[model samples]
Target chain A: MTDISRDVDQQKYNQALEKFVSSVNGNTAFDGDFQGNIKPYQINQRMLALNVLRNNFPTVEKILGESVFTSLAQVYGKYYPSTWWDVNIFGDQFAEFLASQINSAKADAYNWALIAEIAQLEYAFIDRYYYPGHDSTPEVLIEFSHFDYEAQQLIKENHPNLVITYNCLDRFQSTANGEKFHSSHWSVDSSQKSKLKIFSASVFRQNFQVVSAFSCSTANL
Target chain B: MSSIDSFAGKQCSLGVEYMGAGLGLRFPHIYEILSQKPKINWLEIHICNFINGGLNQQLLYELSEHYPLSFHGVSLNLGGPEPIDVAYLQRLKQLTNELQPKLVSEHACFTSFDGRSYHDLLPVPYTQKSVEHFCRRIEQVQETIGRPILIENLSRYVQYSENEFSEAEFLSQLCQRTGCGLLLDLTNAYVNDKNLGISIDAFIDALPHQFIKEIHLAGFSTHDEWLIDTHSAEIPQEIWNLLELYLDRYHNVSVLIERDNNIPSFQELYNECCHAQSILDKYPS
Candidate 1:
């Protein structure tokens, strides 16, 4: 068997760094097995991953309640660190991370799922923002066809996150053909680029009314 | 001009082009920005959120036809040693092609390392090694987008003992080396001054100010005896004073007022923008 902790080289230094991170969250204890000084780069990477999780999942951070969340995120980051240039992709496993914590099973109705969904929505927004060729013209609308089955068949291709109800379908049927249906309209100014990707969903705010949620997606029409 | 454009214009009248004095557009204020139709110069939206299948697509067509917009990003992480996000850059390139924004900017700091991202804008150590890293990244980004990238100075609470040069020096070198423009955040300079114990003027003097494509002014907070760039409060008097000094020093500079948190009423922001306009007017070329 290859001795993983005995080598006094870059590989050993990397293992030591991983061990130090694991030790932060009680996963592994440091044994002073490696040689040389601690690297600033290692310290920075550990801190940055922890910070990304902390920022992206505010609710999880709240549930873990600061100290515990910080500690766990630090640990989780070491093991399943982000692989993307954008930090927004880091909190993908936050829901799973939260589930592993004590008293995690007793979260509120819109707790983990809500946060996960919201984070997903946030990520979708980011993805859409970065998506190219998002044409701003109304000519890109999906055709609603009563005669041709193939036209409305495209509904299956719509984003799964897009909230669709029998009522919405009925409303759409009621609207005249060739007329754009805007249940809710949010504007993006000229200086700004619009990249919403998720299909509209219903969100109930303080008003206790179901509201449409816009998606961020690829700009390519 | 439309009521919206005029309102946005009144916010930041550079007396030339209309990038407008704008606030970081958040989800909460979408209604107010649209309904009130306030005469603000421009609105800055996050590039990450704006292009995705959210409000950007839902409203962009209508909004773009009406008002001017700009992009402010936090995820570029230009100072990192890791490979840049090509997809993100591609999307940004597409968004810019569509939006044709007057200005698009990112921080001078690195937000990620080793693939994992730190969402906050973390400062880059001002050293020759870091400078080279940033310049190469900036060149890549600008090349990909086919536009000059405006790099903003970050407000850091902690200073690394290993940093060999001042922030301004590093920025000047980066611009000179990469041909990228500078987005001088005056408030960040103030924060660095207090926390890192550097003179504000010395920080200003070190940089080649003529290459500044834009300026960002925002408010900050103090925590644990350290000056933090929270972007959540009103611009402090001292920072505003510093801004005035900067405007006086650099004529014909495009300045922006950034309010990312604890955002006040639109009228209040417009009022503050008018103050910025008045300052710029006082130092007109």
Candidate 2:
């Protein structure tokens, strides 16, 4: 082909590819002027989205059950699309997506607030696992007994990364029902009636492992 | 002469040192590899995994101290319509400068378009226009990094109708135009042979042999009528035979045994490395 014709052909090829990508991103349907079949491409996009969600949100998947979770994830993937090069960040907006879904869900069927809280907790854990700041600084060994009360208060105020938030009431109920924290098998129980509460705890990383303090209310912080 | 005999006993002209048989480094095996210290010649790592400074960075630094490492990237998106990402390239350049790996490589495919990343290696159409586009981006990458990058052919399921050149011919011309090297992936060639009905031997022979700097051996899974490059299984006998053929032809090219999913025990992976080493041992390099 001549140089001009080759350029024209390549332009057409790029346009078709962009169209196909748009289809995968759920912006439009797969209708492009290309010679090859689009089914395989579609399959690849869905499989990738499913795999990434499966990796990042095992807890959410278990809570919603695999079938429902996967279907919801497929729809969420289409609307959100992947904006990051790293698959680690692909499901960053999943908690928000789940919250939106819960808002529209049947009120009498499931505990949407509890589900949304679980999603937020799982997303935070994943984010912290990959967060560079977690490993960037050396762990400070603060001796509370040696410090004055004012000094301790100053330290608590300055060390913001040490604080972790959780829904204490849900956690207590879930544990009473024989569920372990950070366990993927945990499911919400509708039988127990309790008020929702928030708590903050100081978390520490020693020897490359995370340890959380006993739960405390926001008033303590 | 038989196809294998045609290029037998020939020395590779790529000038890269023979690093012998190596394996891709994975997170699960990091501690075991460091503690046990397997008897492998070198290692290859996905550069993106170690781009951020953290536990992986610390582990990679220790691994580099023990073994000669090579960086293989998945997100260069060299064949995309947009220009190569400057910030990504700068990160890569910084990494290469710090690590000084023996060789650096990326796919001859695009992974992103229009500011959205698919996070998968999307195939480029085999056309003169594509060749020009890919070569221009590759040249830019090489200039930014201060080294020639090896481009690996992708395992493709679909072929565009406007392709003006065969994949092999396009790769050969790409190397000639951009001064890059080829990272010949035997499993991808084998998968394409099954799905696209292209002759593996012909495809291998058509490539510019002198430009082949490294070889990758991996396994693929079968999904219905298509052979997907899942990299989750053991090396098939057919792919092993193809690697042997390539080694017989080009004696100095480095070989990597890659397993990303369904990762086996370190001993099992080492045995595969030993298998490749046994072939390399026959060539008297």
Candidate 3:
């Protein structure tokens, strides 16, 4: 083939590929057999991001057992495979997908928030472990003061890689052992002056360890 | 949390085998892994909520007392334009200190950009700015974790115009500059090969094998001829061939199987592990 023809063919092929991708991704409507004449082996080459199944069937894990959950996931996977690369975020319309399924209402009856909260909790837990902290310098120290005192206290307490803004001051307490930091309350002491403090919060050795003391004085106390 | 044994030239915990291959330990299989005890060399603890909301640390400590762990995580969102989540980092550090994992891993993809989290590992244009930004984030992560991490290659659907470097070269440079290891996801590489018209061999050849500390193998389904790394299903034959190729070329490599959904029975997964082990045995390390 001539160079001009090859270029035209390549351009056409790219256009077809793009259209097929758009159709599968649900970006564009696909009325025809989108898989085309691709070989069965070739069909397996197409990518299906799990985000679609995750978002679509968040509670499938609870209503149905994991085995059934996965079988259902496969059905959805065939019908609405994700075209995006980020598998974790692909299942945006999963709830809608559930509603379309057999007895999906019953499944939806299950506390999705609980499932989501669990997933979020799980994600956050793993995230806290792999998360990295910033430099503990004096300049950087000032920025931490903007955080609420109760939060500061909590940081001083359980140095778990979690961000819980104190809902009340009852939540904060300095542990005697210096190793154990626990907080049941999230509220801050509004009366105590918001003083700057250099709290050394470390996610060291699989523990949320902290060493904190006030950096600035409170005139009230 | 609990005392673990330091094996010859390496470390070992009670139930956790350091045979090298790993899989992201998920909730569905928790009982199975603990009860049936599928023999995994390493268990990649997903770092989503291990250190949050006052979950009993003693349970995990007990698990660690019994098993050796390596952490695998999402939500780092390093490419997110917002300032690094310091609270997140602090919690991560605490967990790492507890686990003392063989290695911790995260995606090379950015989760958020410009402060708005897409909550996905979105692709970045392989530009000089991106390279520098990514390196800086990795440096910060290493500093926070007090150790380096292996950043996995992402399976992307789109390309950013800002990209100037090939994925391999970018990873090679990132490892060289930051002293970070590469979590080479063969399935992701295969996906990129189909999507981006890259030669898989050349892409592998570009990276120095020494920088590749870990390998990821998983099943992928297709959409419009694009191979998506979904971490569901069994490992595809093509990917197995690719794995064999990778093993043949790189020895002493730590490998893993990632099954996010369609989780089979522990027995079934053990069969898959055996398959992988046989391949590894052929090429040792």
Candidate 4:
């Protein structure tokens, strides 16, 4: 084909693909988007993004049931569609997304700020998990007996990759951890901060494992 | 199944056996694959999973020691309009240099567009312009990696309203232009056959036999009333039938039983691989 015809053909493909991308992404609809059932394609993208969310934000998935988690993932994905090549890093903005949703009354399923904080902790967990710490597991483990007040600062200085995330340790645990806290107890709204004395929740690796081990500041206090 | 004998020595691939059946290495089976080390032909790796230094990366290195690994990537987005992602390519090049995998493959679909990345594989249009565009990208990839890579066909929900070439014709031209091989996915062809009226038989028959280097057999699930390529459940009878059809024409090519989600015990997936191996045993090698 000649240059002129090729250029026209290229322009046509670019236009078609741009509309297809926007439509599948739920941004805008054009006449006859692509050809066939695009709903499944859209659904599949959400499912793929959910797998990434489940990996990065396990605490969020656990606190929210499977159905709720799936819905949250789809909605979160539409707002902040991933721009990272690695799906493992897809949910970097999710903790903030959850906080935004709850603050805006878009999601009132859980009234407490703990859910969002757990998401914050989970994000840190994934970051530390992906951090190029060591090819092999580190020989020494972090001991809890070392620090009283200045531990967070000291640990940050020592391990630059270490992440100390979130406060209000107990409420997040009560909702997310093994023993189910009563639903009535899960009403610690962020607005009522002084009513409940929130404890600090710092995540650290007990061993070299990627899964984060949680600790509270009550003992430190 | 002509040998890549010319390309193998310098690359350290050294004539991949194309053992009738292989398994996609997923995280669930890592420990079992490490400890139990079940009998299998070869293993395919998701290139993105091992890029950053993580437990999965460590595990992949360990697994590479045991089996001949193939790097199959979803994030390259070669079919998309974005200029080649230099950082991603560099990481892939580093990983390829480190692992010395038997084969490296990416999809013929777009996973990113308009400055945003997508996790799922989206379809590429079958126009001559698209063919030329992807060829330039594929050639760039080959020049960067110093080896030809196979492009896998995607199981898509929609087809473009207008096409200058059929899927088969497009793939054939793509390989001829860029010197890449085809990762013929029978499961995807089955999905397209059932969801759209595209024929797997015609797709296979039309392709030049030499271009097919690997075959993928994956499970599809019906979600939201449409047959989606979930790779999360059991492979249906129709996909198995398609595999038999594929094996009849082709021999000594790598075949992988791909299961990403709803992963079964390693033994169960291995059993499915063995089932594929049994069918291969029936045919002449």
Worst ten-residue run, lDDT, model 2 chain B?
Answer: B5-14
lDDT of 2 by residue, B182-264 (tens): 99999999888888887888999899887788999998888777888889999989888887777767788789999988988
Tens digit per residue, CA lDDT, model 4, A1-221: 78898879878878778878877867786356466777876666777778778877665676677888888888888778888787786888886777777656555667336566556544654554454444444221222221222323333333323344334365566657777744322333344332322222222223323322223333432
Q: What is the TM-score of chain A alone in each candidate?
A: 0.40, 0.54, 0.35, 0.54
Q: Which clashing pairs does model 4 show?
A: none
Q: How does candidate 2 fare on TM-score?
A: 0.78
A1-221: candidate 1 lDDT, tens digit per residue: 23442233324323433443343334554344422222323454667767666655554455446786677787787777666554445666665655444355445532454344443443433444334454443222221111111111222233332332323333344554655557332222223233222244443222222233332212311
lDDT of 1 at A147: 16
**Highest DockQ among the candidates is held by which one?**
4
User: lDDT per prediction?
Assistant: 0.59, 0.71, 0.56, 0.72
* TM-score of the A chain in model 2: 0.54
- Candidate 2 pairs with clashing backbones: none
- Residue A175 CA displacement from its true place in model 1, Å: 13
Interface RMSD of each: 8.5, 3.9, 12.5, 3.6
Question: For each candidate, what TM-score against the reference?
Answer: 0.65, 0.78, 0.57, 0.79
Model 3 residue A186 lDDT score:
18
Docking class of 3: incorrect
Q: Candidate 3 lDDT, tens digit per residue, A112-139?
A: 4334333332233332232224232221
Candidate 1 segments whose C-alpha is farther than 4 A from its true place: A1-91, A94-210, A213-221, B1-20
Output DockQ, candidate 2: 0.24
Better of 3 and 4 by lDDT: 4
